[model samples]
Target: MGLEFNDETFRGDYTFRNSAKAIARFPFPFAEDSYMYSVNMEPHLPGRPGSVFEHMFDVDEHYVAEMRDRAQVLAEDPLRCQSLPHMTLAGWDLLELIMESKARDYPQWFSLTKDGNRWHWINRPLQIEQSFTFLDETTLPYGPMEYITRQTQGDFTLQDQRDDNLWIEAGMVTTQADWSLDFDIGMSFHEWHAPVPLAHEMRVFDRALKFLLNLQLGAPVRRFNWTMTVDPLLDTSPENYPKWGPSKTTMTPETIGHRQHLRVELQTLHRLPRSNAIVFPIRCYLIKFEELVTVPKWARRLHRVVRDIPDELATYKGFIRNKPLMLDYLSKYDDGAPTSPGIWPE
Candidate 1:
């Protein structure tokens, strides 16, 4: 069957919701009861059919709406999509990677025809068709990275590997978890990650950087990074904190279940074949506490994880203020049962 896209908004009345299929496949990040900082990297291999990992880039029900939200974000702030002049080639490399992957993985929704440098691309869901010369910027409405990523449902950053380090040079970041692409655009790996607590002292970044610097082509890695958001706000960026931050104060026990959301980012890193730069795509997936509790295992495990998580970690995740309320809501579903190992619902 073809995918059924959802027509919902991420902000302004917050009409977002998850169908049963979406809830079943939500990437709940907690592997065990509690969460911590670790280099929990794994090979980005395909998984069970119908799951998000089944494809190179998972396009879900929210694809169309998310693209609209991205366009709105870009219109409001063009800085959200940027590439250093030297990074244009890397952008083209990223564009080719996404186009080929989507066309191969989802032929019904997307198709690409290539005759040497000339290429014709069609995205059925978005109703966009364009024929442009490969590596030629003038033919496209936007830059290569922006053009592809606008249709893509994730925040992408292109890292240039140099001087035994990965430099954050180019990206299209809109649905971020309290990070600023504009501020961290020119920073090195550690420099941008310096703000993250415990991970730096734990040498997580050091080991991760070393691992990525030697990342082989065709072999990408993925990991999960999660946080808590007051609502289904995709653009939880520092640049617009004032707009969404105040909502955190309005969550009461009566509304906690519907208002609070578990924001999980399925982050994948790939080495671009031509530019030799790593394109990191951080796909944000949000599930409300009420919808997530539908699965007994997830509910029990999430309750324990939130209840037992360290205060510093909770504070850093921007949910410390609502931790008590979350525990109050999630605790009702936790029956002190032991959850099985791994993130899957058993």
Candidate 2:
């Protein structure tokens, strides 16, 4: 059977939610009871049948709703999606990659037919159908990267590699975690990541840059990045901080379970075949504290990770103000029972 897309909102009335299946497949970021900065990358290999890692791009029930949210974000601010003139070819490369991957993996919902660059694409879930000449920008309404990423979940940044560094030349970043694409548009790998705490001191980005500089085609890599969001607001960019920042001060122990959300980003990097650029897709997933605690193991480990996390890291994640409150709610689930090692619930 085909997946049933959720009809929900990520902002304002905040109707976003996780079904039993979503919670079960949630990519709980921590594999241990602690967290720190590290280059914890792994081969983008397929995993257990029902897990999120099972596909190149995992499409969940939130697909259509997330697209709706992306459109809303872009409508409000077109700067959320931008591409340098030179990066247009990279955008086409990205479009081809996502279309092919989704069409192959979720054939029921997406399909692509190609006849020597004359392509027909259909996205049943979003009710989108387009026949555009591949690499021909005039055939599509938007740039290539913006076109496909609009239909696909996640925020994508196309990096141009030169002088042994990756340049963030183009991207569609509406669902970022407190970062602004407009500000970081032309920065290098290190420059854009400089604001992240301790990672540079630990030489995490140094080593990561070295590894990605040598990334091979058809051999993508992925890693998990996580942070805390007070609500299920996806457009948590710095531009809109004033609107969502005040949310942190409103959380109480009584409401934290429902209002607090664990935001996990399943970030994958692929070497585009044509432009020789790296396409970094940051796919964000959110599960409320009440829903997360449904899994006893995740509950116990999360409590320890948050409680014992370094104050600096907590502050950087924007949850230090409510750490005590989160601990109070998560503590009830820890129970001091030893959680089995590894991310899976035993």
Candidate 3:
């Protein structure tokens, strides 16, 4: 059987529907009640014919909206996009990968052409057509990675393998789900993941890095990670703590369903062809718990996982302050009472 897990970006343009189909297809992360970190990587391939989801990558309905949001974020804080001097080649490689993917998958909106080392790109969505030489810094206004990130939903992280390990050498991350790319840059594979409780004890990261190192060009790997957020807005980095900080103490039993959301990150890791750097892309999705309980199975599983979650893991996830309220809210779903509006009747 394929992998299953429990798992938005906000652009008011996108509305999450609480339909049976959406609930049935939802990536529910917990295999058991409690949560713990693991490598959880799976082969990156295209989805089955006619399937709603894609295998390695997905250009969702929110693609354009999220890209607009990213452009705004970068415009407001340029530091959100960074790259070291040595990662120039890797940046170019990633730009090509992204541009090629966009042109291939979205022919109507994007197209790419090449004449020897010179290339031309037409982006209908952004309303631009430009020609430039590959690897020429002056061709693109910003670095390749930074320019490409403005057009893709996921924030990209490029890690270079050296001394038998992968070091985070560069990335363009404007809509950080929660973690900071600034702090994670230059950290070794193990060092960056040190804060994750179980992955280290279980040797998950060690095994994962080994798998990543051995990964070939055509084969990519994907995984899922999830958490809860108080709002639908995407910018939750430490810099915006003041805006979302009060939600922890302010959420009550009645408002929990509407105010809280289940935030899921679909992380895809690709081994770049030329530079051999690992290209990590994180796509964030959000669905309100109020919308989640439309499916009985999701509601029950989520309740059990939250109830059984250990204090340390919960605390690490910033659930310490609001766990009780969330649990109480979920318990009502388990008890078969529709606490929120627009309940799908059994």
Candidate 4:
């Protein structure tokens, strides 16, 4: 049997303490590698996507015999070719002050901060949790390859190491007889809005509201969360595994892609008086869970967010020549595919 679970829940947590100067990191869930791309869009020289892990895999030879020195990485494809302006990530977003911090320019470029006029960022926190049951391991790995789970479902609470933020991720197997739950909680503190993309300071809540609500897809289907509340000890001191600092990981670019859908709901408060206010809409996926990673290599053009699809998305005139998002890119005429059902080939 593959990885099978009857239930699933995904949550996306985000905090924008600083909009500019902050950074964004994209990491693979299981792979201990990442393509640390910058959010500033300040024009990086160009960096190889899969280099660090490659070097790490050969650490024994490089560390002593060959040895990886600073000069070695600097001369590489990604590091040398890409000219990225230095930007520090994971620092300075104060704490829960997400909206207030976003209200102004953050990480205020080196030039501005050097002038001695410092801007304020709350040092926000973000967390994303993915838990579900898998039935088979055809194309995907049978078990988690790298980001192994030690324990889950009990007292689940993680702290914001870099700052005051705290996050907890957990899961459990509730059964009809011996129902034991599994909890996987990861906690860390980092700065948001430190990057420039969101720093565009796109100040229009309505659009964000639409995306969160999935407003265009029709009415929403609310879910009733069934979770256990447990209090886990605040672990600040680090010994080794799961603790912050230099970690030996297998995360790579290939691991992070093709993730499942997500959902989130947050209640926020504003300045002066910590008063009750609007509840930010949660991001939910209309696509079923099983369909998330099942993509067709033949069809690349239609693999985009549904919102970006133009009127052409409604009709499918060909099959093998031009594939559909699913079997039915156009949503009409069944392409008469025995192997695939919802295809679009008139």
Clashing pairs in 3: 5-27, 5-28, 5-29, 6-28, 6-29, 8-285, 8-286
Write one digit per residue (lDDT tens) for candidate 1, span 1-346: 4779999999998999999999999998999998898999999998878888999999999999999999999999999999999899999999999999999999999999999999999999999999999999999999899899988999999999889999999999999999999999999999999889888888999999999999999999999999999889999999999999999999999898898999999999999988999999999999999999999999999999998888889999999988888888999999998899998889
User: How many steric overlaps are in each model, in order?
Assistant: 0, 0, 7, 49
Of the two candidates 1 and 4, the one with more favorable TM-score, higher being better, is 1
Candidate 1 lowest-lDDT run of ten: 1-10
With candidate 4 superimposed using the best TM-score fit, by how many Å does residue 16's alpha carbon deviate from the native? 28
Quote each prediction's TM-score.
0.99, 0.99, 0.86, 0.19
| Candidate 2 residue pairs in backbone clash | none
Put down candidate 4 lDDT per residue, 1-346, tens digits, no spaces: 1111222121121111111111011111111111111221111112233321111010111111111111232233221111111100110111122223222322221011111322322211112123322212232221221111111111111112212232222211111011111211232112221221231244433333333332221122221111101010111112211431221132223322222111111111111112111111111112221232233311221233222323332221111122232323322222323222221211
Q: What is each predicted model's overall lDDT from 0 to 1? A: 0.94, 0.94, 0.74, 0.19
User: What 10-residue stretch in candidate 3 is worst by lDDT?
Assistant: 1-10
Q: Which stretches of candidate 3 lie over 4 Å from their true place?
A: 1-26, 31-34, 48-52, 335-346
lDDT of 2 at 155: 95
Model 2: per-residue Cα lDDT over 101-179, one tens digit each? 9999989989999899899999998898999999899999988999999998999999999999999999999998999
**Candidate 3 per-residue lDDT over residues 193-229, each given as its tens digit:** 8888765778898898899888888788787788888
